[model samples]
Target: MAASSIANPRSDTANQVWTDLSPLLQFNNMEIINVADGVTSFLIHPEITTTVGRLKHCTFMAVLWEIWCSRNRARFQGQDMSAKHIINRSMLSIRAITIAANFQKILQPWLVALCQSNSRNEILKVLIPKVVRWLTPPPGRLKMNVDGAFNMTSGEAGGGGILRDHKGNMCCAFAKPYHGLNSSLSTEALALRDDLSICCSKGVYEVLLETDSLNLLHIATR
Candidate 1:
C-alpha cells in the first residue's frame, strides 16, 4: 500500500493519470487531441469548461459505471451472447427506452439513430425540432407562430411563419428563404427574425414570437 501510494500519490500527476485513463471511456471520435502538457481544459474559457466537463464526465461516468448493463447483456440472463448479435445489442436497448422515455431519453435512440441514419446531419434536420419541442417547449401563442426547414441533400432552406391577434384569429402567414449550413440554429434564427422583421415593418411592437429552439432564443436576445 505504501509503495502504491508513493507511485500513484494524489497529486497533479495522479489527476492527469486519471484523465488519461478516463478518456478510454470515450468514443474514439470524441477524444481531444493536441492537449499540451499544461493545458487543463479545451478552449481554455470558463464558458466552454462546463460544456466540455459535463460531456466528458457524463460519457466517462456512463461507460465506467454502467458498462455491465450494456456489455454482453444476454449472458447474465443465461442466453447465447456472441459476435453476430453484438452490434444489435445497443439497438435492443434503445428500442426499449424509446418506448419508455417516449423518445425523450436522449442518449439511447440518438446514438443508435446516428449510427443507423442515412446522413446523420439529415436526421438532425428531422430530429432537432422534435428534440427542441420536448426540451425547451413553449405553448403555442395566439400572437405569433414560427416554422423552419432545412434540406441536407439539396441544401435548400426555407421558413414560414404566422401571427395572430388576441382573439385566436390568423393575422398573417409568412414564408422566406434561408441560406446557410449552421444547421438548426441557422434556420431557427431566420424564423424568429422573419417574424420580428415583419412586426418592425408594420410599426407593430411587443409580440410573443412562438418558437421551440431555446438556443435561438438566447441568440436572438443577444
Candidate 2:
C-alpha cells in the first residue's frame, strides 16, 4: 500500500485536481516525507484558534478522510475514484463542521467562493446571528414547550417536551423514542398529543402550548 492516496493519487484526474487545490492546501505539492509531515506542515504556521486556521484544519481533515474512503473503494471494491467526487463529499463534511463550529459567519463566504472559484484568501462581510428569547405564559398557566426531530437518513424519530410554570421553572419533562415515523410533522403532532395527555391527567386545563415549528403551531391553533 502507498503512503497516502491524497498525497500522491495514482489517477491523472486526481493528480490534476490535487494540483488545482494545492493553493488552498498551501503545503501540498511539496516534498514531504510522509502524510503526518504534510499535515503537520499544513497546520504548523497558523494558530488553530484563528478563523482561517480552523477552516484550513477542517478542510485538510475532511480531504484526508475522503481520500482514505476513495482509496478503500478503489482498492477493495475495484471502483474508480474521481477527485471531484472527493471534493464534493469533503465539502459536505466541511460545511457541516463549519456550521457546528459557528464559523459560518466567517467562513461561509469563502466556501461559497470556493465552489465558484477555488480561491480561499478573501474575507467577506460578517453575518449576525439571530437572537431568540422565550416569553412567559399568563399567570396561573403552565407553558408546554415541545420539539421533535426526524432523521431523514436513519428513519429515526424522537421528541421531548418541558412544562414550566409562569415563573419559568421546569415542572416536568418527557422524552420518547419513535421508529418508522414518516415525517417530523407527525412527530410534532404526537408530541403535542402526549403533552396534552399529561396535562389532562394532571387536571391542568389552562395551558399554553409553545413550539418552534410554525406549521405545527398553525395546525394546533386552528
Candidate 3:
C-alpha cells in the first residue's frame, strides 16, 4: 500500500518488485502490508551494531537506491529496466560497499552465498588499508610537503603546504587560492613552487620536498 501510494502510476510494478525482494528480507513472519511496514521492520528488527544487522541494512539501502534509480530512468529517460537488472545492480552496489568497508570477514560469506547463482562471477575485492607516516628530514635539512585540489564545477583551485624541520617542528605554512587552473598537477606544481619561494625568502637552502602526487614528482624531477 505504501509503495502504491508513492509510485501510484506504477503501483502494480512496485508491488511486483516488493514481492520479488521480500523473500530476501527477514521480517520475522510479520506481513509487510506496505512500504511503511517494511521500513519499520528494518528500523526495529536489527541492532545495527551486529554484523548480520549491518549487512541487512546495507542490502536494503542499496536495493532502495536501485529502485529509485529505476523509477527515475523510467520516468525521465524513457527507459524500462528489468527487475532482474535492478536486483543485480543492488547486489553489485552492496558488494562494493561491503568490500570497501572491510566487512569481508563478516559479510563476505553471506554475500557469496546469496549471489552464488549470479551469472557474472564478480570477485569481491577487499581493500587493505595502508599505514602512512611522515618521516623527518636529515639533521641539517628541512622538509616541505605540499598538496593541491580543484573543483570541477566552479573551476576553483587551491593549494597548501607546510614546512617542517629535521625535528618535525613546523617552520612555516602557506595556503593560496587560484582561478582558471585546469588540472590538479598544475596546482600541485604551483604549491610546490610557492613553498620553495618561501624557503628561499627564509634562506633555508637545504631542503627535501615531499608530495603525494606522483605526476608532480615526475614534473619536478624533469
Candidate 4:
C-alpha cells in the first residue's frame, strides 16, 4: 500500500501523511508497518468493536480523507499547503471527536441521575444561569440592532432590524426577505444597509448600531 501510494501520482500522498503521523500512532500503541496494518489492528481490538471505538476508528478514516483532499488541492490547484497544516487539521478533528464522546459519556449519566432525583430544587441547583445585558443608547441617540438568517435548503435568506430609544422602547422594526445571497457576510451587510435606510427614512440622525457578527462590525468600523 505504501509503495502504491508513492508510485501513483494521483493517489493520496499517503506515505508522506503516514510519515508525519507515525510518531503519534506509535505513542498511542498503534504502531504498524502500513495504514492497512494499522486498520487491521483496530478492527481486531475488542475495545475498537465498541461504539466509542467505532467512532474513533471513523475519525481516523476521516483524517485520511482530509489528507487526501489536501494533497489533491496541492496537486491540482497549486495550493501547496504544508503537511503540517494537514496534521494540524487532523488533530483538531480528532480532538473535537474526543470532546463529543466525553460529553456524551457524562451527559448520559447526568440525565439518568436527574431523572432518578426528579426534584425541582435539585435540578435548579445544578442549572447555571446565563444573563445577557443589552446596552442602552445615550439620551438623544437611537439604537438599531440587526441580524440575518439563512435557509440552506431553499437558498433563501432574511434580514431584520429593530430601532430602540434610550429607554429601550422599540420605535420601529423591519424585516425583509432576500434571495440568491452566496454567504452570511452578504446577508449581514444587507441587514445593516436596510437598517440604515430605515433610519434615514425615519429622519433619525443620531444613531448607535449593533450586530452580533464580528465580520460585519469589523468591516463597518473600518
Best by lDDT: 2
Model 3, span 103-218: residue lDDT tens: 53454456553453222345435332344579999897889999999867667899999999889999999999977799888888889889999999999887899999999898
**Against the true structure, candidate 1 has what lDDT?**
0.48
Q: Tens digit of lDDT per residue, candidate 4, span 90-170? A: 655654444445323323332332232233235333333233479999997889999998767556899999999999999
Number of clashes in model 3?
Answer: 0
The C-alpha lDDT values of all candidates are: 0.48, 0.73, 0.70, 0.64
Q: What is the per-residue lDDT of model 1 for residues 1-222, given as tens digits with 9 covering 90 to 100?
A: 222222223344323433443332233212435333112342132332343333333333333222333233444545443322332343344334333444332443344432434332344332221222222223443467787778676677888887777666677878988886547678867887788888878766867777767887787679
For every candidate structure, what is the RMSD over all alpha carbons to the true structure, in angstroms?
19.8, 8.5, 9.0, 14.7
State TM-scores per candidate: 0.36, 0.46, 0.46, 0.43
Q: Rank the candidates by TM-score, best first.
A: 3, 2, 4, 1
Error of 1 at 124 (Å): 26
Better of 1 and 2 by TM-score: 2
Record all residue pairs in model 2 with backbone atoms less than 3 Å apart, i.e. clashing: none
- From the highest lDDT down, the ranking of the candidates is 2, 3, 4, 1
Residue 4, model 1: Cα distance from true site in angstroms:
79
In candidate 3, which residue pairs get closer than 3 Å at backbone N, Cα or C atoms, i.e. clash?
Answer: none
Ten consecutive residues with minimal summed lDDT in candidate 4?
111-120
